[model samples]
Target chain A: MYEERHHSEILEDVLQFIYPLIILFGLYIILTGISQPGGGFQGGAVLVAIFMCRYLVSPREMGRLDLIQKIDKLILVFILALASMLILLGFREVIPYFNGIYNMLIGILIGIKVASGLTVIFYTFAFIEGGKED
Target chain B: MMPVVEKIMYIALIIFAFMSVQTPKLRRAVVYLAVFSAGSAFVYVLLGAPDAALAEAVIGSTIATIIFLSALQKYKAFTVYYTNEMRHEYRQSNLFRRRNAVLERIENFCSGKDLEAHIMYTTESLQEVMKNHGWDIIVRRKNNKFSIYGMEQNYHIEEMKKYIDENFNDLRKLGYEIELHIGWSENE
Candidate 1:
């Protein structure tokens, strides 16, 4: 119970800037990842994890973000699908981005996946949190 | 397989993540997120990305976490107000700032009304805004073709736009650029 309360307040506040930063951060991790560490999965997961973090951070701020959530989610899905599908298309015979140059595309897909997955988790949690008086 | 240290860091991350998940309030979750990020940073360090690790620490532990707590305060979030003034500052600041900001926005709008434009700029010539909403009306030519007479608005550009639109239209029609533009904002 304390955990929930503590996190709820914290997550809510963090979302103000964290969400945008997370997306930016994910991009940073992915784009720079090839030459360095942090490939698709970790970077992408981190991106989406931001959403979950945001959701957990600010459940009550839902009213403010209601429209944003819906529209943003739709856009996110399209982006992720497009990115992954593009990569998949490139891999007609073999996995795309055999070279590291196109690896950024893969990183993007991973980031999108991470973003969407966690967004869903948070979205559901927010729904539940809103349903009851806490 | 990841390193033992990395594995341990991962475990810490998971534990923190779970803590955030189990924690109901937003503030606690934010703090947990910070902790989780710190743990992830450790894993990153273990994996040889000290830069990423440092970033995570700064972002996760300090900046992001503080903001998250602030949001909770905004939302009447879970509380640990150890002091009255601290509680008062947290509780009142948002409301006050928002209220003032709204009023300021409105006042900015009101002030932008150019209540004295007819008196200020005659049906004159072209001028330039030095900065945002800076009204550099060329009352008189200075040091050759150089212009003068300027006023910078500290208000939303939208309000300034309305002022320009309302007061300067005649000038605009007369081929006098109002030297003012309304920016994109809530007023739009």
Candidate 2:
């Protein structure tokens, strides 16, 4: 399962500039998503594209899994809280101004959850690399 | 307008993603995952989400490949793990090579077949009552680890342990965490 890391190529510099632009475009698409066709899944998948790009060029140099994994777990908790808050606050509480804030917070929460969830896509490969020996 | 082409590309991306998941081998899976990441990144560009595409290209593909490869070298490099958890006794000794001086000295003890006669087992009175066995069990230096290979001797696990118990003064011991692998001529 362990793979050797290929040396960094000259193409990395070019890839670096390219990935961030992709992120910005994804953000814009997802933010305007309320009226647009795409929603959280598409936006998050697009967001993970940046991480994937770096992995393709030089997979060995990467080690962001621990950080991403921890965040991924937290995002799920935040998402659950947001969902619960939405149900309780929207149907039970009759505050219009608070709803707007709640929606905004939910939007932000969704972004974090989406970003974190996509890390699993990367971890499927990482699990291959992880093993203990005698 | 060629809306069909766009739909085909989306379908391809989705198929590619699932294909990555379907790969049986870890390396092949990683390769598919890389392809999936690249394909998705392209989809990102088409979807007008260039930044997300970039992230997929950078972190998803590159970093994942890197970590997986490095991990293989130390632990699971080409080590096949069966999904069926059969409790098998596997020997790690075949994969390990030692180049220690004391071990070299022990191996070079050329007096043939009976080095134990020359070896005197002494706990240094630091721990045990001295017993005189015909076999000369001589090891020096307390708390130092010793690698002893038994040739044509299938010493029982308790007997091997007794060696450590008897020779504490010059033995590096694996207390409570010791592992024993019994091998015979028929066992590889």
Candidate 3:
């Protein structure tokens, strides 16, 4: 069991400024992932770090994250279905932009999936260790 | 230019790896390992493997660190020191059999809450334990009566108190009373 530590007001104030920027940066990474060096996984990890930082600031108010877990699992199923459809269709040079659109959609889905999955994990640990009921 | 940067990255990787292993706290170690992963990802980039580098930077540095830190939390054991009024002989076999209903209830509560319960049947008094070693909960028994001492901020203990009061209401006929005392605990 871990005790909930009270952080200084300055720390919370600084986080207020920095937290939104971190989230914005994570979104930037996710949106530009297809063309840039970073992809869905890297951007998703950044998003997870944003959630983790909030917990670091205030362990008491983790809020409900069960929705995120449900969405994460739902996205996983969607990804599997999409992958199977792609294999079955066999888009062999028929449409040029179809491949690009497919990749972009898949990348977006993966990014959201990873972000929600990691956030749920963070909340789960925070629930047990920080001792917040939900 | 690339070779020089690659050489520096390799040296940094080695240092981070060494520091991670040698760090006293697991949290610090996780940070160092993340740095090590970042350095390795840079090295991969220099070697013209961007795909591998991206995977390394994300999975190895961020996701893996979070997972390791979460797993490390399980190491903090939830200790319960139970001291009976009459000191029984320290028999390894009978210790399990000698467990009272209250202790059994505590074990059940701890298990249901996912806390690793480390219950120790001690011969020492509560004052000695409070003044000496660190502990989460203390259960003392005196003449078929039980008093459970827990930290005031401990929600789990509060839940346990409610559980006992609700479940063991029938035990009043057996001349047994379970009392819960919540107060400030050391190391809070």
Candidate 4:
């Protein structure tokens, strides 16, 4: 059942070239989401492609999933806290220009949450659960 | 032209959806599902919902497919080791055909039980294979006699024993001796 890890030079090279570009694009989508069609969820999903590509490069190697899971939970709490504060403090009424900033902040937070959440799920299925069979 | 393109995308979506559901192999079904997702994403974009299209394309087509593939990889896989002692005799065309026929039957049985059959032919002796490798089934052929070895705890062994007994009667009549050694101990 133990087999040698297969390496594809072409895949490695191409992914190396596009890795930074994908990150930049995902960040761009999330940051500009307040003014554009793309938003946190979509941008976060795109960011997941980075980890997926990493998996393709090396099936056995994955970043610390527990850390990502922690980040996901922490982001969820932050999003909830921010939303409640906005509602309770009546910040929207007092500060007219705060709307755009709040939207952008929320968008960025959701994007990070979605990215980390999906990464955790993907790695769990691909490696953690699958490793038991071996 | 735009309407025609939309119609074609809609038709592709239907076809892929049906194929994903109807395909027998889990891996092929996953691919079909990915294609279905991509087709639907296109339809969404055409309908002016770029946001939904982006979500479907990334999640359904890419992430879901990868997850399904990894799950399938860890699913039930039936490994069979085939060793032939009569290396010279196995070169004969008829013996090769007979060996393939036996493997085909085993494959059919595995598919019926929703298992993927992986057959490996090795020059190593049956005893050596038993000692070194993890296997669901081992078929060792010494001339016309075939010894099938399997573990006691494997649920499929009993079913396979019945299958061979029922199906290999013709080979028995042809002077082939097929023996089933169930509950085979690893130490022995």
lDDT of 2 by residue, A14-125 (tens): 8878987978876775666555544455566667767766655665555567788788788778879878876776653666577556555565557656766766655555
* lDDT (10s digit) by residue, model 3, range B1-188: 98999898888889999999997556678999999998998899999988678778877987788777657554556779888758854678787677677777777777677676778888887788767766788989888888888887666777877887887776666889888888855553
Clash pairs of candidate 4? Answer: none
- Residue range B1-188, candidate 1, lDDT tens digits: 56777777777888999999987445567878887887888887878877677557655675456545544434421111011111213344654555322123323434344221211222222322222222423233222221223334433344444544565444346544334322323332
Give the CAPRI rating of model 2: incorrect
> What is the CAPRI rating of model 3's predicted complex?
incorrect
User: Model 1: runs farther than 4 Å from truth?
Assistant: A1-22, A49-98, B1-40, B43-188
State TM-scores per candidate.
0.34, 0.39, 0.56, 0.77
> Can you list each candidate's DockQ?
0.03, 0.07, 0.18, 0.61
Worst 10 residues of 3 chain A by lDDT: A1-10
Runs of candidate 3 with Cα error greater than 4 angstroms are A1-4, A88-96, A129-134, B23-27, B66-188
Q: What is the lDDT of residue B112 in candidate 1?
A: 41
User: Local distance difference test, per candidate?
Assistant: 0.51, 0.52, 0.78, 0.87
Q: Which lDDT tens digits does candidate 4 get at residues A1-134?
A: 33343467888999999999999999998888888778999999999989988887877787888889999999999999999999898888788789898999999999999999999988888887746455
By TM-score, the candidates rank as 4, 3, 2, 1
Give the DockQ-based CAPRI class for model 4. medium
Each candidate: chain B TM-score: 0.38, 0.39, 0.56, 0.74
lDDT tens readout by residue for model 1, A10-64 = 4466577677887777777778877876655556556655555654554444443
Please provide the root mean square deviation of candidate 3 (C-alpha atoms, Å): 13.5
TM-score computed on alpha carbons, candidate 3: 0.56
Model 2 residue A14 lDDT? 82
